[model samples]
Target: MTVDTAVIATRLSETFVAEVTGLTISPEITSEFGRSIYEHYLDHKVLVFRRQDIDAGAFAGFGTIFGRPEEHHVVKLRHPEQPTLTYLSNQDELGRNKEMKTSGQGWHSDYSYKLVPGGATMLHGLEIPVAGGDTLFADAEAAFAALPEARKEFLRTLRVRHQYRWSPDRTDPWARWQYIGPEERKRTPEITHPLVRRHPDTGRESLFIQPRVIGSVIGIAEMAEAESTELIEELVAHITSAPYVYRHSWNPLDVVVWDNRCVLHSATTKDLDEKHVRRLLRLTTHGQPVTPSMPKVGYSRLSSR
Candidate 1:
């Protein structure tokens, strides 16, 4: 529970978000400091470390402290040299497909549809837009805490099914925001995960329903479609409300680490807006991979030769 006074950890707001300063990151960071970072991460679901000078190698190294880095399902955005790194931006990367623009705009926990979702997802800003490209994160842990006792009991009995290539959910206003093309849709069978699950280390229950990914929501005992739709809308509204949210305005070289298990994050226009170019390096750790795990070394992951 102790951190070096030289390094300061300050709460970003009343929410479960914090900012840490006075520490430097490298591929080979001291185990003690990395451990401290992990402890703080568990305490605070979101952490901001500004002015980092880390590269792809160091970013992957930092990620492995919690778990082996998980390659994002949308493989096209991955870095050429680092399999664990995802480059998010409106600008293009060398040798990358021109059509692969910034994606993942909707609110979601990274790899939420997987049986086991990721823990920490780190995003380091390389270039930030002049204005209006901020990331919004909602604290699921807090949201769960604020729910009604009876509703919490009911939520525990629900299951959500996610289909990769399924049709858009008419109930979700932003259903078409993240397009899943035909080839990518059939890569995995439908997955059913708990509507409410506990954070691995913290043991606190948080809602896990991401309607953008979850094609259907039903009670384990079989609920009607209209009931399920109403439940999904009710939950989404409750979780994303302002009291549970923290808006992160980016700075160049800022590294943000958020617990995917307890946070629902949405990328602002900077990640996709054509009018402005925004770029960042993201590393996600510890999740069940549908595809083969990307090797941590040697040749990079390339979708096309």
Candidate 2:
């Protein structure tokens, strides 16, 4: 079947995001429609496709339009038949959608801890809560662009370290969860990417820092731990401020995709409970470094190593 249809894109935010309508997704989506979605995705950091009632298999197929779908580090949460699709749910039995682990509560880019971070993360809402379960996104590009030229130049010269499950407060609940094992730790060691990362495809620069998994600036002899922490906090606050953010309140069957290189997203658990189940299928695609080369340092659980 020739799937020829025109997709209508309306701006959700002035420049940060857009909503694409008029295209129904399927495993056999035409290349032309897929290309149009990709173009919108690049132009706007986030694209929301309304009312896509597709299964895990079809969602996995739709993800290929962005790039090769990459398996999330959390293996158990992945769909049984479709390994590339992971469940972001508040339910235990993923099959039943009763409740389990709730992912993306923190403001961070997907897979930023890895040497090669994820390029894009797409989520398809299966079951949404009555009140909350909204996802918030910050436009890193806009945040960076808003900074003074002097500050931008300074950020460009620095590299920030990010580690898996590394939190400033060890008491933080996310750090307490021992989901990432020893071997997985070895696979995802401490890595450093430029503070101001230029999108490889777009050549646009964005502030890149995962506050939840962030560490100090590496290779800076003069910068102390306190100074590094202060800097990270400052930048994270700027990137996540209201001016750059777009809050997405999901409805069932809504498919939302965001650019990881230029967008920081966090999940809200406002009214999520046993009675109100919020379940979404998530897929992230493989990504190369924002810059050509980044230093892959060895493992270290401690904040400073």
| Winning candidate number (TM-score) | 2
Which pairs of residues collide in candidate 2?
90-99, 90-100, 91-99, 91-100, 92-99, 92-100
The C-alpha RMSD of each candidate to the native structure, in angstroms, is: 8.5, 7.5
Per-residue lDDT over 1-305 for candidate 1, one digit per residue giving the tens place of the 0 to 100 score:
44555446898867689998777777546355776777677777798988988777887787776667877655676787888888876765643444345345667777665556667788888988778678989888788878889988877777777654343454453443245555565665567777777665555667886554332323222667677767777777788898888999998989898988778888776234666778888888885322211232332222110
Pairing residues by index, what is the TM-score of model 1? 0.82
RMSD of 2: 7.5
Q: How does candidate 1 score on lDDT?
A: 0.69
lDDT of 2 by residue, 1-305 (tens): 11224666788885488888777888556365787677667778798988997778888988998888987555776798999998777866654332135456668788776788888899999998878889999998888888899988888888777777766565555562255568876866677777788776666778887564422123222467778878877888998888888999998899999999889998876346757877788899998776822233321211110
TM-scores of the candidates are 0.82, 0.85
List the global CA lDDT of all models.
0.69, 0.75
Total colliding residue pairs, candidate 2:
6
List candidate 1 stretches off by more than 4 Å: 1-7, 28-30, 72-76, 94-102, 169-183, 213-221, 270-275, 288-305
Best by lDDT: 2
